[model samples]
Target: MVDTTTTTASPGSRLLGLTTLVGLAGLILFAFVLTEPDVRLHPTTGEEFGQFDAVRLLYLHVPMAVLTYAAFLTCAVASAGYLLKRRPWWDVTAHASAEVGTVFCGLVLVTGSIWGRPVWNTWWEWGDVRLMTTLVLFLLFTGYLALRRTPAEPQRQARRAAIVALVAVLDIPLINRSVEWWENRTLHQQSTLAELKIEDLTLFTLMLGLVVFGLVFAWLMLHRFRVGWLEHAQAGHEVALAIAERHAEMETLDVDAAIGRTGGAR
Candidate 1:
């Protein structure tokens, strides 16, 4: 039987592709920042271009947040495939996406903290629904990855991981609406999808471009899934070799006993 699971790209090729994407993301982000003034003026502090002036940070923050969601969504879809078809590829997809999503979630939290300090006057706030929910989502996904580390039979492991991925995804929508769902009494303004339009429309377009660039997460997820599949295949091949060797030894012993019995009869 042929093993079709091996990756087509050499290790060097995969590394090159990753490097290219990272470089492209940096260029796009730089271009987006150069296009406009990112910071807004505060009416009180007389602070124009406060830390918020690092408007380019939005380019990083929004994309990381979006990619964090995409990562989990990928995990959910992959988990579905595992549940339905029992394929190792799907399990690989789940594990890889979960890991990637966790990384982006962490990025979003850190960038949000940096942006918040200058604008909101604090590094952390429990009163902010969006912030709190985002943190919770990140922690949940982190736990999901940890749970996948459990030692169990392959099929059982996949099923358990799938359940965790799908369940945790429920928080994505919750986090998005956290601000409206509960008022934190914070000075932070209420968030709205319509407000996403305030930026001269061109800025909105650039933001959308940033969102598309964020799909780089999907590309990363693809490569990670491929690596996972290859690892799973390699393990399978090793197991098969061990089983075959044992079978061959047992056959040799059976033939030796048969020959001795025949010689004694003769």
Candidate 2:
């Protein structure tokens, strides 16, 4: 019997899909429509300058960046588990998480660049500490993924990828703290949420965005894990089939030798 429950979508995943869709719709409504554009007078300049409409992008950008961090961290933990246990489950989970995290990290860079264009008057600045650190983090993970694709033994590949993930993950902390570590040289602003700069509906929407995107990340993880597990199962099945065929061939040789000896004795 086919395991439709796991090999395909289960009731729980269907429900999660529905919930994610609803949450995404609500996030879009609140972020794009209900929330007011960021408008504030500069303290020193006495001039009206804020992100304005562009601030809306933060609703998606901030949460994605946060989730990107979460995904990579999950990958690192799973990779550690794989190294210790040498289980296919841990390896699959680590690969899935890294794949998902890489996508999220890419989206973060894109969104940050778009948001930066109007606010910072530049799409990208090589000198900015936060930007440079984030770019490095992205590149490291990209290399990790490339290393995974390189032809090698399965165990060797997993081991190398796991080590790369562990090493690459170290960049996350620097990227996260770059703004604080180099506040003077960074173009990125400090955390507004930490400072309690937003109020009422605006804060609510931002929080809602986090919840919605978290759901998105969860959904992606579920599917990716399922796919990875399925692939692992298929490969194992193929290996087992080949071994069974080899055993059958050996048995045939033994039977032929017995028949030849009986005939010679007769």
Candidate 3:
């Protein structure tokens, strides 16, 4: 009874986790083992051109990047709800999504760097507008998380975090459009799915990766939200307990003083 929210597990979460695990395994096999390497002979130069073995990274990097966008957008929506309704559930959802989104954003950057090493001949390119924008987005949410930790009233903290999250989400559109807008300045390839550049097993594997990663995002968000809510509840319980204890101490002190006066008078 003292600890009502002890575990972050439910039957639904366990099933989703299993499904995500299976999907991940299937995606890896399709992307890395069954799918052909992206090797193509240049028509004019008669030279091999493509990501080759490095193309395998496309499945993970691209899916994570998309899910990162989804996660942040979810955060933004929840933050807006928190500001409008001043509800604890909204605030908890916003915080949970931002934390999960930041992690996914970090993975996107790392995977992009690894993928770039072979395709772009560099681990990172400062001038790449997409990369820079994504980094800024990551840092912004990270700052949002840090701001939540600063000592303040709970309502005040939640309000500020909500506002910061709403503002930080603006970078997502810029990151998405950077490749097209800054065609010359950025080294990012245009959207392959949009252009229908990928075909057959490669396309299927990429889509599978999206589904698998989406499941991953859901699983993480569900657990994190539950944990955050539980922490919030625990804090409230502790405050109430402290107040009750103080009242009990005051009552005990009053009783002791009354007894002493009566005995002395007698």
For residues 46-164, write the lDDT of model 1, one tens digit per residue.
77664436555666677678778888888899898989999887899889989989988998999889878877788898787788788898889888887877777777888998998
Winner on lDDT between 2 and 3 is 3
CA error at residue 19 for candidate 2, angstroms: 0.5
| Residue-wise C-alpha lDDT for candidate 3, range 113-229, written one tens digit per residue | 999999999999999999999999999998998998898899999999999999999999999999889999899888879888878788898889999999999999999999998
Candidate 2 to truth, TM: 0.91
Lowest-sum lDDT 10-residue window in model 1: 184-193
Colliding residue pairs in candidate 3: none
TM-score of each: 0.79, 0.91, 0.93
Q: Per TM-score, what order, best first? A: 3, 2, 1
Q: Of models 1 and 3, which has the larger TM-score?
A: 3
Residue 47, candidate 2: Cα error in Å is 4.3
Which numbered prediction scores highest in TM-score against the true structure? 3
After TM-score superposition, what is the CA distance of residue 204 in candidate 3 from its true location, in Å? 1.0
